[model samples]
Every structure is written in C-alpha cells, then in structure tokens.
Target chain A: MTILFEIKKNYELQKVTWKEKDILVNTDCGVKQIRIWKDRALLDWHVRWRDEVGKNSLAVADRMIRTSEGKPWVDMGSEYLTLHDYVEGTHERSGHEKRWGLLIGNMLQAGLELQEEFSSVTKEDHYSFDACLAAIHKLSKEYNELVSVKNSLPEANKRLNLAMELKKASSHVPLPLFDSDTHMNNGGQIFNILFYRGSDDYPEHGYQPLRRLLTEWLKECGPYSLRKLLTCINEHFSLEREQGYLLLAEILTPWELQDCVVQLKNEELAHIVSYVKSFEQDWDFNRILLHCFTDWMDDKRKRVAL
Target chain B: MSHSNETVNYGPILFQYDLYPEKIEEVGKVKKVISRRGTFALKETSLNEEEASWFTHVIHRLSEIGYHQIVPLYPTKYGDYTVQYGNRTYYLMPWFAGGDRFGLTREEAIIEEIGKIHFLTLKEQDFSPEVVDHSFQYLMQRWESRQLEMERFAEESERMPYMSPFELTYLSHFHHMMRMAEDAKRRLKDWYDACHSEKRYRSVLCHGKLSRNHLLYSHHGEPHLLNFEKAVLDTPVRDLAVFFRKAVHLSNWTKEEGGRLLSLYQRHIPLLDEEKSLLVSYISYPEPLFHSVDLYRHQRERYSQIEFVHRLEKRISAMRHIRDFCDLILTPPPPQPLDTNINTDHI
Candidate 1:
C-alpha cells in the first residue's frame, strides 16, 4: 500500500516521487526517499544543495508513504527542513555558528509544536516564528526604557527600575538548546555573546544602537505605561539585585566613606563597591573621581550654611 | 532553767545598721556589735519577704530538732526566729564560741564545699508526701511556664531589626533545649507516677537551690547545711546536680577539679548510674532557664547596652555546648522504657 504526503514551502507544494516499491522525493535543498512494505514504512532525508550566495541552501526532504494497512509515515515540514539545513551548514562554517543555529532550531521545533496545538493560524502564514520574535523585541524595548527611567529616579527608585529591566531582559533571552536527551549544547559564539553581553552586567554603553532601538519603542509607550512597566519589573526581576546591592553596601562601608572615597566610588558603579575595593589595595582612578565629587558636594553644602 | 518574768531585760543589745557603710570603721564597729550579741554571727546579704518566710520555716523546723544552728541571745517564748532589721532577717542559734563562716579561700574549696552539701541526705527522716509533691510540682510548673515565655519572646525578636543574629540563633537553639527539657519532664513524670504505685522508695529530701550561702562552717571545719527554703521530697541527686552546676560548673573549677569534688561527694553518698545520668540533664537545663529569665528582664528594662546584649549572646552560643554535654550524658543507646512499651503498631 502507498499514500501520498504533500511537502509545502511558502506558496510551493509538490508530490514527492517514490522508487521501486518506494517513493523518492528530490528537491533543490535535499533528497528524501521513502519505501512502503506490509505493515511498515521507512524514510530518509539529507541536505544536498548550495544556494546562489555560496551559502548552503537550507533544505529538508520528508518521505511520506504508508504501510500495507495505510498508516501515514513521515512528514518533515518546510520550517524543520530549513532549520536542519541551516544547522548543518553553520556547523561546517564555524563551531560557534552551529551552536546558535542548533539552539534556534530546537526552539523553533518546540515553538512549532506549541503553535500546532493552540494556534488556529497555519504555518503557511509564518505567524508562530513572527510572534516569538515580536515578543522578544518588545521585551528588549521595555528593558531599555526601564534603564533610562531608572537613571532619572532617586537611589531607592533606581532599584525598582533596574529590576524591571532585568525581568524584560530575562524573558527575551533565548532558551538553551539540547544535544541528545540529557546535555545542552550552547551554540559557541552566540551562546558566549548572549551570556556575556546579554547579562545584567553587560556594557550598556557599548550596545548604543540596540539601546537606542529600545529607547525609541519605549518612548512611544508613554510615561504612565513606562512607570507601570517599571513597577512590574521591580515586582518580578529587580528584587534579588536590590537585595544584593544592599548587602554589598552594608558590608563595604561599615562607616560612611570619606569624601575622597565617595568621589572615587561614583565613577565605577559598574560592579559593587566591595568588588572594586577587593581588586586592589588603594582606590583606583575611578574611585578618586568619585571621592573628588563627594568632596565638592560637601564643600557646596558648607557654603550654603542655611 | 527557771525564768523570772519580772522586768527581765535581754541585755544591752547594740544593734549596728549599715545600709552602705562609707568606711571600714563602720563595718568593723558593726562586726564588733554582732560579736557581742552572745553567740551570734554575721549573715551576708539581706533577705526578701519570701526568703524571710522560708528562713523562718527552716529555723522553726530546726528548733524542733533541739539543735539551733541560729543562736538567739534571749530566747523568747516563741524562740529565736526573729527579724533583725526591717530589711534583713536573722535567726539566733547557740553559735560555737570560735566558729568561722564558710569562707571559700580558694576555688577548689568552693567545689569541695559544694560536695559536702550534696552529701547531705534526709534518708532517715520522714516528710509529708503531700508537701513534697506540691513543692516539686510548683517548681516544675514554674520552669515549664518560663520556657514557654522565653519561646514567645524569641518569636517576637525575629521581627526586630535591632535583634542581633547571634540572639536569633540563640533563641532557636534555646527552643530546641526547651523541647528536650520538656521531654525529660514527661519521662520523669511518667517514672514518678509508675514509682508511686510501686512504693519502692517512699521519699527523698532535696535542698532545691543549693548555693554557697546556704552552707556554714564550724571552728573545727565541720560543714553544716543551712537554708532548706526550697527543700522538698525529690531525688536527692537533683540537689547534687544543682550544687554541681551552681558551685562547680558556674565557678572557675576545672573538669579535673570537679571530678575530684564528685569523688569526694560519692564517698559521702553513693550515686546510682541513673541518678548520675539525670544530673547532666538537670545541670544543662537550669542555666538556660536562668539566662532566659535574665534576657526577659533586660528586655523589660528596655536596656540596650552592649555588655548586657553580649552576655545574652554568649549564653546563646554556649547553649549548643551545654546541649551536647547533656545529650552525651543523658541519651545513652539503651532504649527508654517509654519508647519500648508504646504500641507503635496501632499508631
């Protein structure tokens, strides 16, 4: 017995061909061959072509036939085909490139299953991937807005804002990919970049372009919306960070630091004050600047005398 | 002796009162007056109303035995149990001519003196069982209630910012100790109930709070026990445990020195293995009981001095060591009677 399975990509659909007692499907991306026997079916697919850009063309072939009882066999959709092809090609290019491809591939497959279960929208519309990407983008924008607003608030309020940013950041961060049943394979370069740069301590100044993108979207959200967003961040994300900050402050400064120390401290708020102090015996250049700033503030207070 | 009631004076009684003597002269003169009171000795510290009543009871009981450790110059019809100053109470007995106060010249002497006190047993004397049971029950109830109050205070301290982490830890440990004490109490009570029906040992007298102040010495260095205020019918080892803690453990006596003292005590009055085991539990529980009281009182005064806080903190830290010692001594591998007899199959 034999059964026909349709392969569709974008607006293109084709009936895969079969060979002697089997069906063979050949496409530009890969070749998939299928065979049927009494009460059993077998199928195999592999990548076979390169695109015009000299990049390996993303492809997948799923051979679908039937057993003697007419049970349908294999169905590898266009998205899985594209993802698998992308992963294989990326692996050939660089070890790091393959990691991100694998991560995204796993996520995409899971997302596809989830979409199939709940979404009335079909894969033809590409709504599932679009929705995920959109959600991540929205979260990034919200985070950027929170960081900016936090800078404007008082020290106490800053904590709430920072927490908001962290929540937004965490939600958008991609889930790690699995290699086999037990182990996770973090895509090399992509994983490193995400862990290092996408971290809470990532250089906010260095990612100005992304930050600007976030800021633009956040401005459209309105001040009230932004505040509400920050409150949500504080409620969810910033609590641990706030606690860590307070603990650091208490341990570092048993007594109030001198004006010189305070002026020097402000320049490197990047790490905790204790962490900075732990680096060297004497205060560094950044700490000196902070100390000077504090001294100046103290002098100004004395002059006002009111 | 023939007594004439016609204008008989009790001698020229020179009463010397020094609330806080400014100079050694004042104390010296007072001492002279006390010496002149014909067979009299100075009692250190003033007594409160409860202590006075307890002292009165002791003197009255001692008079009935015909040997008055308290010497009254003029024996009134009622006897020598009388108030000296409005604040301080004294009982007059026929004092030995050159009897010395039990002065602890060295730390070893203190432990030895404690051992002497523990050796005292009223094994031959008959006491009212009702009185003994009532007094023992009262103290047990007091201790139990105090533990509960300390626990509640600890729970309250958890919410306080000023409460030191050390204090919080101490309170937690203390709660554990209290639980062990409560367990011991239940077990002991069960044993007591069982023993009551069996009538094996009818009653044993205990000097509840055995301290240095309750001891006296004769010119010949013979030790005499005083102040049976908290005396009641319980295991005599309970008195021994209290004496060991208050006079031996609390003092600067070394473990070796304490062992020596214990040996001396055992020579005078032998201890059963169970009695020795129970001693550790008794010693471990009381210090915390006293400490909890102190903490509660300090909190009441709203005193936040570092010294006071540090004392409480130290006690809290010491609790674990005390508990370990208690467990090492009390919780042997042998299965408890209660544990073995309980019908675990049904429950």
Candidate 2:
C-alpha cells in the first residue's frame, strides 16, 4: 500500500494531500498536519513536554493527535508518524515584538519545567573551553602555510584569552538544567523568531539554549537586537542574576571561532586561501560579538547595583 | 431536550476529542453532542485534580477487572480522560442511543450491577477497634444531633399561634418521624454490636450516589452504568441504602418490589447479617424529613406553602413504605399467636 493509504488507514482521514514536506489533511474537526519522525525516544520526549505545557491555557505548545487507539504515533517499518493541528501564522518577527520575546521566555521556562525528566533519558554535551582552544591552536599551526589564517591567529588567541578571563570571573555561577534547540537563527534575511506556539523539536536537557540564542542574535542582528531580546526575556522570567553571568561566560568563549578554524582544516590545498579568508571574516564577526556582549553585561551590572 | 447554539460554548472541550459538534442537545446535566464522527455524551463536572484522577482510575480499573457494563470514558486526542478548561472538567463517552428499556427498570438493573461490582471488589478488612469505634460514634453523634435539631423545629412550630399548611403537615408527622429515627439508631447499635462480635467489616467500591438516573440501557437492553463521580471505598451497605432510599420515592415502588430488588442484588453477593442491619438502619432513617424541615426553615421563600406541604407529605408516604419494608425484613414475623383451643390439646 502507498504511504497515503497507510496514513488513511491509521488516521481515518478521508482527504489527505502533500503540501511541500507536510502532509495536510482536512479532518472533520479541522485541517491537520501529519508529520513523521525517525526517532522514537525524541518523539516520546516531544509528546510529554508538549502535553504538559499545552495543559495550561497561558502557555502555547504543539499537541500531537493520537490515533484511533489513543497511540500518539504509528509505527511504519522504518519511521514513526504523528499528526498535529495545522498552524497558519508566520513565525517571522512582526510588530508584536514584546509578545515574541515573552513567548520565547515562557517556552524556555516550560523547558526548564521538564528538566528533571528530560535529563534522565538523554545525555547532554559538555562544553570545555580549554579543549576548544587547544584544537584551534593545533588547527592554526597545521594551516600556517595559509597566509590569511596565520594572520588571524593572534586576534583569535586574544579573544580566547578574554573569554578565559570571563569564565574565571563567572566560575561560581550555576548553569540551568534546561537546554533545547534555538528555533530561530538570523542566517536568513528575515528572522523567524516569533512563532505563536512552541515547537516540539527542542533538544534534550543539561545544555542551555539561551546562550545559543544570544550568540545568534548578536551575529545576525547586532548587539542592539540581542539586548532587546534579553530585556524581553527578563520581563517574562528573570535571567539577570546568576543566569546572566553564565550566558556572558559562554558567549565570551570562542567556541564558534574554534569550529571555523576546524572547518578550515578540511579544505583542499588549492582552495585553502578562500577557506582561510572566509574563516578570517567569521573570526572578525565573533570578536565584535564578544565586545558587544561584554559591554551589555557591564551596563546591566551597573544598573542592577544602582 | 432543548437545542441551541451552545455548541460553540463546548467547542474547546469537544475539540480535545477531535469532535466538532454539529448539534448540541441538553439532556439534564449532560450535553448530547452530534458530530460528523458520531454522537457522544459530554459531561462537564467541577472536579479537582485529585477527584478527577480518582474518577478516571475507577473507570479504567472497572474495565481492567473485566467489568464491561460501565460506560467507557473516551480519551482525548492528547490522551487525557478528562480535559480541564477554566474551572470545569469535561469527559466524553459514546451516547449509547436510547434502547428498548422495557424489561428491567433502571433501578433494578442498577442494583444488580452494584451487587456484581460489590461482589467483585469486596474485601474483608482487618479488624481495627479504633476504626469501628470511631465510625460508630461519628454516625451516632451525627444522627443524634440531627434528631435534636428536628425536635427543636417541631417544638417551635407547635408554639406558633396559627400554622401554615406546611407547618401543620410537618407537625403532624414529626412524632412518628422522630420515633423512626430513634428506631434507626437502635438498629445501627445492633449493627455495631454485630461488627464487634464478628471482629471484622467488609468494604466494597460503593457507588456513593446510587440512583436510577445514573444508569442507562444499550440497544440490546444491556445495562450501562455511568456517573461514578461519587464512587468510593465504603461499606457495601452504603450503595444499597442509597439506592433503596431513592428507589422508594418512585411512583411504581412498593414493599414487594423493594424486597424483590434486594433479592436480585443478593444473588451476586449475599449481605452479611451486620451489613443487612446497617442497610436497614440507613434506609429507615428519616433524614429526608429533617431535610424538608430545614429547607422550609431556611428557603421557604423559594417555594409556595402548598409545594412544601406536598413535598413533606410525599416523603412521609415514602417513609411509611420504607418503614413497612424495614419492619418486615428486620423483625421476623411474630410467632404465630397460639390458637388457645388447639394448643392446649397439643400440650
């Protein structure tokens, strides 16, 4: 039987059609999006977090539609399938800036709520600044023949040193338990950060997504936009105390620069110049990001003291 | 049944089940929802978190224990038996279309089902003197206090220079009602003593609010019980008393009918002597009379004088029937009076 036939059999929807990647079906209740998942454990976590958050009228989260037998997902030979109510609004940042900021905060808070349960099921990646710096140093030496890369090595070390200072200063601060996917990035011309409902595809616990959000906002929209986002998040849930120090420490660290340098190692000898040049551009971008974040933290600290 | 645009009001609740109600009909407290998927009964209740969990547990447990006579609760698309919106909790179930409810009245079927459930879940609790004493004393104190309140009301009414029709009606039956209350207390004492002697008590999952209205029949006349909101673990006598008391007020009820109903229930689980005495005491208690007087005293403005009197009189009539049933069941037929002429020869 065809995939549509399989879905029809399981979901009992009469009219189903593909809209790009999502399978849109006109259900008796309303239009719904039928999506498939490759990972069962991930899907289980999604279902639990969504169910918990969706129970509250104040918080908005995606809810999975159960099959006739009340199972949240159907097992095909290779994949699992689930259904959801089709949301029509654009996630693009609109005039509702404050609303977007509040939503992001609330969604993160919901993530924090599931920290205990999520931590037990999945292991989170630990970030080691020393290991990252060591890798970058090794990569710069190996690619010393490339002029552009050799020229940027000192600036990279200087940035790493500053990040080390910040880390040492904030070493006493505690990291929050919740970590999930930063759903929006500034890579595109339009920032898609204002979705009305929370996504179910959040990452597992033990890592903080707030740091990623800060880094992305700083890179894509500059320091001003990042400051506004932090302000909005503080309005919803206070992250200005210990959480602030943690985010600043992580941001000041040169994880992205290390990643850029590592990627430079994979280029062909002939293409090495172009790759090095690109790496140099990214390095410069990250340096500006660090200064902007440091300045924001200093300003915040002074205001809090006052 | 009244139909209107109330469908929108319950849209969020029904939407949880992936149902869009095309038509909504009010059937007493339940909303009869007709949707493209099928017809369903959506009951909205005010249940707290704990009570909602217990209600769902009871329903699921009954099904787990192979009892298929209950109306099964349908889970939402998100897989919750109950969906909480605002302050109200909602649950959905198949409508179970009205069937040929001819053979067995709802009351009789309810009693039989109650008995089957009691038989299935009945447990003989370990003897605890403190529990027995506490339960007995608590009930005795409550009954005595209520009786005293009724006595005060009676005295107050008797002192009135001119009595209203309701006052006169209540005054006339007050003495007899008090006597029956005292008799119920005596029977309760007997039950307590029997429990002490037996060194044990039995508890079942009692349908705490037993009435005919809580039961329904399927198309093939299979009884489907619903409304287990007040279900709890208590003496088996609790359900029997609730059912018999409510059943007596029905127009077609008689002493024989009540006896036959009890017998039908007894087929599944025979009532122990103490349990039987407890049932008798519960059923014979004239709490309804006291409730009527309380209503008259506090909320008489809500109803006409004639209405209060009519309600009081109806309860009095039902109490008389209950009295007869209790008397016949509790007091063995007095030893046949000696035929003086024939007995002497036999002696």
Candidate 3:
C-alpha cells in the first residue's frame, strides 16, 4: 500500500528539496505539509501556517499541496467535512434506502470534529463554511489517497465508493440555511458552505433553457407567476397531509411521476416551501428550481411566466 | 563689414575671407578663418537670454536626475554663446577632446554610447500630446510626399538628358531599391497609424538627429553626448535607428559593429518586442539612403562610382537584414543568470 506523489513539471513543490516521505512547502503567507503513505496517493494538509492561534496544521498541509503550482489553494478545515457528510446524509436518506447510515454517521463524526476545529479558529480569524467545503472537496482526493494506503484493498474500495456517493449526493442539494453573521465572523464559513452547496446542486441538463425562460419571464411578467406556483403548492400541501405526494403526482405526468413517496413529510414540505419563498427574489435560485422541475410541469399549462 | 586686404577683422582676430577658393586650407590653427557668408566666430560662452533660460531649465532639471550630457557654460554679462572668436556661432564646453565622428576608431563604442543616450533620454522625458502628434504626423506626411517624388524621379530617369547612359544604368538599379523603399514607406505609414490608433504614445526626450557628429567621447574614454538644438520629445528609437542606418548603411560599417552597438542598446534599455519590431521596419525604409544618394549625386564629381555603389549596396543589404535583426531582438534568448564573480571557463 504505497502512496505515489506524482509531481507535474510546473509544480512549485519540485522547486524545493523534501524528504522522501515528509515534505514541507513554505509560501510567503503559509505552509503546507505532504505525507506519503505506504498504500495511497500523496496526502496534503494545508493550514494558516502564519503566526496565528488555532490554525489547523492539516489545513496548511492541504494548501501546500493544492497550491504547489501557485494555483488557488483550498483550505478544507474540519467543519466542512462534517457539513458535507450531513448534507449527503439528508440526500441519501431522502433519495435511496441503502445502508448509508454508517457512512453518514462516520461523516457526522468527522463533521463534529471539524465544527470544533472551526469554532476554535473562528475565534480569531473568519473563514466561510462554503470555502471550507470547497477546500474539503479539493483536498478530498489527496486525503482519500492517504486513507487508501492505510486500508486493505476491499476496505479502501468500500470507503472510496461511499465517499464518491456522498460527494455526488452533497453536490445535488440546494443551498443550506446558515447564520451569515456567524459565518462572516468565522472567515465566512457559512457563506462558503451555502455557495458550495448552491453551485454543486445546480441542475445540468435543463439549466440553459430554464435560465432563458426565467430571464424573459422575470422581465416580462415579474414574480407574480412564481409566487402563485409556490402558493399553490403550499395550499395544496396544507389541505391534506398526503396531498403533498398527490401534488407532486399532479405536477408530474404519469410517466414522469416517481412511484416512491417523498422521504420528506408535510412538515418538510412546509420547510421547503419557506425555503423556496426565500429565493423568490433571486434569479439564480428561481432558474435552478425551474430547471429542476421543468420535466414535472404540465404541458397543457402555460409555461411558468418566466 | 568690409576688410583690408580682403580680410575680415573682428576685435583681436583677423582672417582672409574666401567665397569660391581655388584651394582651401586643409590644416590650420589660424586664430580666425572666414567665409564670405560671415565673420567666423569661435569661443566658449553660455546661451543668449532666451536660449540660456531654456537650456538652464532643461539641463538643470535633466542633470538632477543623473543626466549629465549637456552642461551649461557660464556666460558673460553680454550674453554671447561662445568667446574664443567674435563672429561664427559656436559653443565650446570642454570640446569632447577625444571623440571623433562616426567612422573613427572605437566606432562601436561611439554607436553604443549613442544608443545609451537614446535609451536614457527616452526613459526620462515626458512629452505633450501636441508635440508627439505633430512630429509623428510630420514624418508621415514627409514620407508620403517623398514617395510621389521618388516615382517622378523613376519616370524621369528613362527620359533623355535627364539621365546619362551611366546614370541610366545606375538609375535602373537604384529604381529597384527606390521601389523597395516606397513599399517600405507605405508599410511604415500603416505601422504608424496602428501605433497612433492604439494610443501607444510614450514620448521620450530625444536628440532628434543622433548622428556620429553629435556623439562625442571624453578624454577619459567615457562617451559624451552633445548638441541639443535638435532635441525634442519624440520616439527615442528613431534616434537609435537613424544612427544605426548611418553607421551600418551609409558609413558601411561591419555587421559585427552593428551587432555590438545593438547589444549595448539592449543591455541598457531592454527594448520591448514591439519597439524592436518598429525600429527594424523604420530603419529599413529607403527614404534616408535615398536622400543621401541625392546629396551625393550633387557632389558626384568628388565621389567614386565604386565607392558609391558599395555604399548603396550596404544600405540595401541593411534594409534586407532589418527583419532578421527585428526577430533577433524580439525573441532574445532566455535570460541565463550567472553569478557575478563566477568563472565559467571550466564548465
């Protein structure tokens, strides 16, 4: 289980001599550490190596490896790893019923440790949670490689699959609600987290057409039709607890409708409605929602104004 | 105004005056030499009130910033520019004792020194938009007008008496070169237009005509720049390019010397790729050599045919080599930093 650190020609890491297994790269602002394991790709931890308290040494190592070539570096502190897993858990539980509980639990445990670390660092300097998440994803491959070197092949494969699934699921969820003030105080961790989630969940296939329609409609008809749609969903869901499922079925054609019931209950529907309402003024959010639900809309109905 | 014995007397100096002489003195330390044009005066003095005020301000300002080329000479209360003689207009300030004109020994050094001056002046000066635009436009107009004149000259060369048999042969060959120059001028106009339209006007103080005569050397072997009358705010590279054209083309200097001078310029100014390209193309224009040819033709009896042809050939070759030199300048070899004190002979 040997980890191989492949060095690119332009990699700044190559500019300095390092020990075969342990290397430290120092930039003007901070430091990064590289650890080569016996059975995985190189592991990098980056932190604010500047003279500051609560700077995660691991974060420095990650930054060192990620920004080795002077490209933008990521700082995936502990908090993001936990939030990433929490979002993945919510998605996993809602979308599919597999034995993802253990994986989610492990992620939450990691997230809690990250939260603790984040709290300590935020006391001094502020960082965004979204930025933290981005840093985590950026450094995930390297961290996974490090883990792979320590684990047996089958075990490592299982963890790799779980990590990949979590990455995929977390990438599809809408932006989460976090205290912007608190996030700003902690190096914008909250904003970073929300941004990461929003960008990741951005629908792929129908985005452009939906965006065009949304732009035209917003300009031509304003937010009247969007508010009506949300109101319709909310009223219908309030009438009957089970009507949420029925509303989903009504909105989607027979062939398009999923037979499986939504994992989120009426209360969750209310939460989602509130969440969707919060984004009524955001063009990007409206576009994403429209793109996500375009297939579910009735063809007979006039296209949502916008 | 009139002189006794056909000689002019101005204060202590006296000299015989000549309008059209059978033979002129080739060697002399005569206290005064005169021409019918005027009583020739020589001396060391400051500029007149108007000129002095201008030089004092320009030179003093430039000198403060390490530019020490043209120093001010103290003037008498009467405000004359020179002192040794009383007639001819001249300024004497240390005389640049050791320097010779462009073709003298240490030719490369003199060329490079000019390049250094060109680089420095260009780096320091700030020019007004009116000055930059006027000079650039003037040159462009002159080039356009010259193109038409050249075409007429080509046409007249074929007519009787306008061109002698030998002249016709020379004209036929010269026409080819002239046409090349015409094409170059057309291209230069376009380049100038592009530079202007791009708003790439970084004017520098320039010694408008940087010829061998204006560049001098001090006794200590340091290069000294002189003559500031033609100084203006314009493209500094024009000065370097003109010097280059005169040295390599008109003066028939070796390519090795040209290379040395160019290297010195590069070492001093580090020309940008675009500047190098513009310079190369500007020098390639046959207009300068064409004017030189016209001047030589008027003095043809005193010039040798073989020497004239040789000089023309050098200029044409220089014109052709301009593109290669431009490419060389623009795509300079990557910097290889060396330890200042390292001896690399073993390696």
Candidate 4:
C-alpha cells in the first residue's frame, strides 16, 4: 500500500482500504485497485489480457492505470504489482453459470474480431506442447523397460507398480497393431515407439493426425487452469453441454491421474487435477471410462461365453 | 407450400373476393385481373404454415397501423389470407398501373418510405436483446471459419510452383477481405453493446429483398411496395443494409453520396445511434467478394479466368465503396465519459 504512495504518481491518493477481495484506493481521479502477484509471466499475461478485454465490460478488469513513468507494473524486489480502475459491483452468483456462458459467447465474438487485429502479430509465442509430447514418449519407454524387468530388479518395484497402472490406462487406446507375435506381450507396448514404427495408415484404423492430437489432449491435458475460466467464456454453448463434453472426454480416458504423478511434476499434476475436477456435478468420469473400456472387454466377454 | 399452375383460373379466386372479373393479364410472376369492382394482382409463392401466417400477419399489421406506402392487399375473405388453388398458396393484392422506375428522386423516395416502414414496425420485446447477441455470435462464427479456410488455402497455394489468376487474386486480396470481416465484427460489438445497455433492440418488418423490381411506381407520382414473399420480422437495420448495398452499387461509391442517402432516409425515419452502428456493421461485410470467391472456387477450371477476373475486379471496387462507407460510420466519436448512471437502490 505504501509503494503506491512512494511511486511519485500524478493522481493524489486519498483513502485506502480493503473492499472484500480487492485493495481499493480512492485517488483524485477515481477509485483504483492494486493487484499483487508473484510470477512475472502471469503478470505479463494479465497485462495482455487487460489490453485485450479491459474496455469491454465482460466481467474482466479494465485497463491498468500506468504509473508516472508509463510502466504498467512495479517489480518491488520480491513481488509484482499493477493497478486498475475499480469497478464497484458484485457477481450474480445465482445464475453465474448461465451468465458465464453468455459472457464467453461475448468473448468468442470479441476474439474472432481480435484475431484479425492480432493478425499483424507475426511473433507467435511458442509453448511446451510439442516438448511435452516428446517427454511423454520418453517416459512411456522408461515405464515399459521397468515393467519388463519387474521380477529381476528389486529397485524397479515402485516404478513397476506405476507402469502397470499406466499400461491399464494405455490399452484402451487402439492403435498400431504389431506384425510379429514376439512383440505381442501381455503388457502394453510403449506409446508412439511401436505406433510410429507401423505403416503410414497403421493398423488400417481411421485415426488421423488431428484425432491423434485430440486423443493426446484428452489423455494428457487437464485444462488451461486459469485460461479455462476466460476461454470457457468464449464457448457459445450452454453450461451443462460444455461441462458434459469435458467430463465425458475425461471419463473415457482410463487413467485417473494417479499414474501421472511419476511422469508429471507436483505443480503439473495439481494443475491437471484442477482442470479434470472443474467439470459439473453428478458427472461420473469413472463410469464413462468403464463404459468406453467395454469395447476392449467385449472381446473377452464373447470368448468367456463360448 | 406448393406450386400452382402457370395459368390461374380466376373464377374461384374472384368468388372468394366476391368480385366479377372481365379481363386477366399475366405481366410477370403476377397476373393483373380487371374486374367490375377493381383491378388486382395475384401471385403464388411457397410458404409453410408458420411462415405464411407470420408474413400475412406482419403485412396486414402494417396496413392496420395506417401505413399507406405498402399495399398489404391480401383479401381477408372466407376467414383466410391465402387461397389454396392447384396445390399452391396464392395471394391476391389490389393491382396498380405502375410505370417505369425513372429517376434518383423516385428511388430516394422509395428508400425513405422503407425507413418509415421500419420505424412503424418496432415493438418492445426482451428476446430481441438475446437475438441480436446470438445473431452477432453466429455471424462471427461463420466469418472466423471462412477466414480460417482462406488461410489454409493461401498457405497451400503459396507453396505451389504455378498459380492461376483466381488463385493469384485470392492470395493478393485475402488480408483486406479478412480485415473487413474483422471490422464488421468489431462494429457488431459496438451495436450489441448499445442495444444491450439500452435494453432495447429495434426489430422491424423487413422487406428482406428490396430492389427496383419490388418497388412499383405509378404515373400519378405514387409508389407502392408490392412483394411480401421475402418479408421477415427482423432488426430494422436490415432493410437499410439491403437498401445501401443496392443503392451504392447503383450510384457513385463515395461517403458523401452515401451520407446524403442516409440523410434522405433519416428524414422519413430517424435512426438511433445503435441502429446506425448496426447498419455500419451489416454493410462492412465483403459480401460481393465472398460471392465472387465462392463462384471461382466452385467452378474452378470450367470458368473463364479473364471473365472471372473482370467480375472480381468489379465486385472488389464495389466492396471498396462499402469499406469507405464503413470508415465514415466508424470515425471514432469524441471520448465519452464512463456513464456513472446506475440504479443505486438495486445495487
């Protein structure tokens, strides 16, 4: 609070107090809120978001009021901070979900427009998407090797338990069939390693590159964590329907993220769980997983009947 | 909805209207019937249960509201607005001896009359707010998808060793069309916000296809809106948008000329800032470019390149006019202070 006073700004600070979640400061111009956070990247993302949506009142905060030197934020040695014009209102919590759907519809409409405005932005921000895929492939190989020697190596006991779980989860995905009887073990083959080795249209399955991406996304991505809240607002659909699409996809996957701990870091796992659990109530991910898994179980059911 | 015969047996139709017909003449799609009582024009069109009833209701309502510019002359006989003859729905309207569409004055008068019709059609409805938002969303979705396809096509075409003239044109002007689409979407937001914050959307009885053919001019200096086939209950700005698309194509494509036309229309029916914004958004779309590209892509090798190129050039010229008009509308008004207006008691 004193940092704002010490900044030697244009607007004279009048009254500073806590109004619920925000720290409100009434300046000579108007009331403004000060935002404090730890991560600079998150702060940078916040600044970009504010610039994109601030003017339009779609439940997003308005533009950040620049300091005297025209800087948006002040790196106060330990933490990052910014300022915005305080909007005096409260959320309509009762129908917030429906309201949220409309807000997202608004954002989608806005984003479609913004996409063109942003067309001049040739500098695309690359992500960990491809790297993450490569990491998963490497991890799957390690898990497979550990499982192959579970009986021989005592040190591989903990990893073998995780490998079994990963295998159970991995089998539901029908892919690149093996040519040799030698490769057909009781356990699942390492993902992509065997899959990529097959023909271009491997196993004569209809899975295209986009479908592979989607399957990978469903099996891997939890959600954008914070981006989901903003991006979900852009989805022009009813709350229940979108929530169904998300939960249904999650449920169809065999893994409950318990096996992901050995693969993904603690923060990553937490974020993934945060995304998976964000689905609407009464939607059973396990039941959906069980139902989809029946495709594989149906082969055994007929043989058992025979 | 069904199609009737080329020749209409006027006996049953006259019986319904309770008139005696001596002569009947087929001018175009409509047949002019001269009776002892009066002259009437009957035309058959396809409409389902709801559409027929709604169109009939809107046209009749306009006459009921004392709008004389439009002749909603559906004979209210036998408790029906339409007569089923030869498995087709038919409408019999009072026929007028219309002359050739002459000058700009006549065209301007007709447009002004349409603006009046739009004003008369407004009603307070809550659903309109939602409809505007939804329609805006739907339009954006379509534009976004189209732009994405164009991008994919461009990337693929760029890598090719040889490219056709159409492909060359598409690649060259891709960004401009896309930018226009973006502008349209942005202006749409402005319109949406205005209507949303005001809690009122201007829904009107729009003559969806307004053209010189649809406007019948008489020797006695009187004009009447004839066709009701494509009339719909939508935002009032739609009629203005359609009119401007046609008008600018017919006239010099300039902002001054366009503004004068709007002024002429505003004289008959004053446009709200929101409606003006909505109209700007509507016309900002590169409809001409969309159609030309569509034709080129669909026809591909069969279509003549030079002919298509000429057509594309003409459409692009017209599109440039539309873009210029949008610029006039979108010139940012001086910054307005944040409206502190709020229902304090409710808050």
Tell me the alpha-carbon RMSD of every candidate: 36.9, 8.0, 29.4, 28.3
Q: Model 4 scores what on Cα lDDT?
A: 0.55
Q: Under CAPRI classification, how is model 4 graded?
A: incorrect
Residues A1-306 of candidate 4 have per-residue lDDT tens digits of 465554334332344444434466654444556777676654554455344332222233244556545567766778866765544433432223333333334333333344433333212212232343454455446444322212222322333344345445544532221111111111111110110111111111111221222232223332232123323442552223332233233333323232333334333433544433432111233333334333324533465589
Docking class of 3: incorrect
Residues B67-168 of candidate 4 have per-residue lDDT tens digits of 887655654222356654334667788777766655556567768778788778776567466677688789889878877777787887788899878778
> A1-306, model 1: which lDDT tens digit per residue?
223343333203243333322334543333433333221110111111011101111211111212222223333332121211111111122222232233323222333223323232121111132333343344335334223222222432333344345434554332211111111121112112211011111111111222222122233443333233323323322313332233222222211112222333344444334432433322232233233323433544575676
**Candidate 4 residue pairs that clash:** A104-A233, A104-A234
Instruction: Find the candidate with the highest lDDT and give its number.
Output: 2
* Cα-based lDDT at residue B65, candidate 2: 84
Expressed as tens digits, the lDDT of each residue in B1-347 for candidate 2 is: 22355865675576567776678988999988988788999998998778999999999888888888998899887778988766788899899886887677777789889988998888999989899999999999999999999889888888999988998998888889989998999999999999999998999998788877788888887898999998999999999888888888888888889888988998998888898889889988999988998999999799999999999999999899998888656754469898767756665
In angstroms, give how far residue B234 of model 4 lies from its true place. Answer: 2.7
Question: What shift in Å separates residue B186 of candidate 2 from its native position after superposition?
Answer: 1.7
Cα lDDT of model 1 by residue, B1-347, tens digit? 21222101111111111111111112321221223223343333366656755666654555564534333332211122333332444433334444554554333443454344334434533445565467448757877886777777677777787876546555656666677677556644644454344433323545576666544565765555555546565676676666655543354445545555666666656655445545654665545545644665566465555555565655644554455545544434456567666788887
Q: After superposition, how far is residue B162 of candidate 3 from its true place, in Å?
A: 9.7
Residue B213 deviation, candidate 1, in Å?
A: 4.2
User: What lDDT would each prediction earn against the true structure?
Assistant: 0.38, 0.73, 0.40, 0.55
- Expressed as tens digits, the lDDT of each residue in A191-244 for candidate 3 is 012111111111122112223333333444345443333333332122122322
Worst 10 residues of 2 chain A by lDDT: A186-195
Model 4 alpha-carbon drift over 4 Å, by segment: A1-306, B1-5, B8-28, B32-39, B74-79, B99-104, B127-132, B152-162, B299-303, B331-347
TM-score for candidate 1: 0.36
User: Measured by TM-score, how close is model 2 to the native structure?
Assistant: 0.72
